[model samples]
Target: MRKLLAATLGILSAVGGFVDVGDLVAASQAGARFGMAHSWVLLLGVVAICAYAEMAGRIAAVTGRAVFDLIRERLGARVALLNLVASYVVTVVTLAAELGGVALAVRLATGVPYLIWVPVAGAAVWLVLWRMRFPVMERVFGLAGLALVVFAVALFWLPTDWAALGHSAVSGGQAGQGWGAYWFVAVALFASTVSPYEVFFFSSGGVEERWGTADLADARFSVLVGFPIGGFLALALIATATVVLRPAGLTVTGLEQVAHPVVLAFGGLGLAIAALAFFAVTFGAALETGLSAAYAAAQYFGWQWGKRVSPREATRFHTVLLVSVLLGVLLLLTAIDPVALTEYMLIISAVALPLTYLPILVVANDRTYLGDRVNGPWLNTLAAALLLVILAASIVAIPLAIGTRMGQ
Candidate 1:
């Protein structure tokens, strides 16, 4: 049971990573428009995230240094600071979206408006980060996120055409959505599933937990099992959306629409469960992004971080974390639609993909860092192929968004 609990920690991190608000919007959008056509993207993202996460965890265990630590050492202080700025911006944007998601969830459960709940949600998230033990926080949110499985349950209860969903997953046609729009959705889905904050949080969490060589196996189990489970849940979200929303030609613009499939199957109760899942996953994601912003900054500057020390002890890290949350709150106060912010975040994440990834790949191969634990020939080949895809997505993301007018 003890070993199982540790394994569960990894799964918790993956669940937090793969299903944040950006994904809640993107996955539902993909399913509603392209049906299961982009399911492969989620699967590909799962594989890619797991592989990279394993490497990051391995490096953390063996080197006793988190990803951003190695990132600074390799990319040097100046370049790493630049990476910190860009990544911090992306992480903050994502944090705002997730906080909005929490508000949306609260609004669904009660009749309160989302705006009313926004500040409340942000305060509650901040409190959790401030006082909660890290592992306990992970377990609670991770388990709550599993509530998303209700969507999968709704599928069986609803009149789902499983065979057609299978066909679409294997065949990546546009289903009349147009190739331009199809690719746009593809980029969004790719970016959400492979959000860079996941890496920052995962590697940093390993360090916070004091993972060492003996803990490598547990870390590996967590990434391999946990992230794939997250991908499966995300895949289920798309499939449910495809089955219920696509024929109506409905595109999701908010949380209510995203939860429509579940509502159709189980009415109020399903809606309740869906909302709860949204709150948990998004809230969990908000914490991760907030910390990731601070992690990137502190790691680059070679300052102390993590909760092992008190806020005063890691003053710089805590200060950055607090500021990051405030920035997210202020951004939302501008009344920009959080959903729009989420979509835009995904695109920008696509653009900055290489900055986070190239450093990891380079560090993963460093003999001094990994010793005999470096990636093998075949793993490197796969990483290269995946890197090519990431580059293509980054390069075309902007052009496609423009040409498609943000997928009209």
Candidate 2:
């Protein structure tokens, strides 16, 4: 039972990276604009994240180190510092976007202005990080995030054309949207799926929990089970949008639009459930991204970090966490659109994907780290192939975004 509960880290990481505010916008935009044309992209992303996360979990369990720790060792301090700079920027921006999402969700539920909730959400997230047990924090939000299954439930309740949805999934047609726009959404959704912070949080969580060789099986189980469940929820979001929003020509510019299909299916109750799910996933992601920003900074500097220590003992780590959340709230206070911020966050995440992933692939195969536990032939092949895809996305992300004018 304890092992099962430990899976919440994976669940939280998956939910935060795969289905957070970014995915909520990107996935629904894909479904609304291009039907199921990007379904294959989501599937590919899930496979990539699972493969990389498995290796990350294994590395942490065996070496008692997280990805950034290995990165500094393998890449040298100068190069790893550069990597940390880029990663920290991306992660802080992601944290800002997630805080915006939490505020937007609050606005959806209470009809209050989202800006009013920004500081409230930030303070709450920081408080939880300060006082809560790590596993307990992850489990609470991860389990509550399952409220998103309401999307899948609403699909069955609505008059979904299962056959057409399946056909579109296989067909990969762009539904009159240009190829540029289609690929734009694909890259955005793909970036959300394999966001760098997910791996950072996953491995950091393993280290924080003191995973060892004995915990390897439990970590693997969590990555395998938890991430795919996140992918399923993301797919349900796509399917719901395809059924309810595509025909209406809606483009999902806000959380409200993302919830429309469910609203259509069950009215007020569905809206309430969708709002709860939105808040849980976004708030959970805010926690993950806040920790990830701090993790990268601490790991790169070789400072002692983790929730296992008291705040005074890990003052620097806790300071970074507090600052990251504050930065997020401040960013939202500028009154930027949370949904738009998420779009920009996905684009930046796409460009920075390889920096975070390449180190994992290299270290996962290094016998120095894992000894006999190194990635085997099949995992290596998958990791290598996924690396190629990630590189393609990175190379093309900016060009696609510019060419499509942010997917028009």
lDDT of 1 at 127: 83
Report the lDDT tens digits of candidate 2 across residue range 370-389.
Answer: 89999999989989999999
TM-score for each model: 0.98, 0.97
Candidate 2: regions farther than 4 A off:
1-17
lDDT of 1 by residue, 89-130 (tens): 988998999888888888888978888888887788788888
RMSD of 2: 1.4
Q: Which residue ranges in model 1 land beyond 4 Å of their true spot?
A: none
Q: Would you list the clashing residue pairs of candidate 1?
A: none
Which 10 successive residues of model 1 have the least lDDT summed? Answer: 9-18
Best by lDDT: 2
For each candidate, the alpha-carbon lDDT, in order, equals 0.87, 0.90
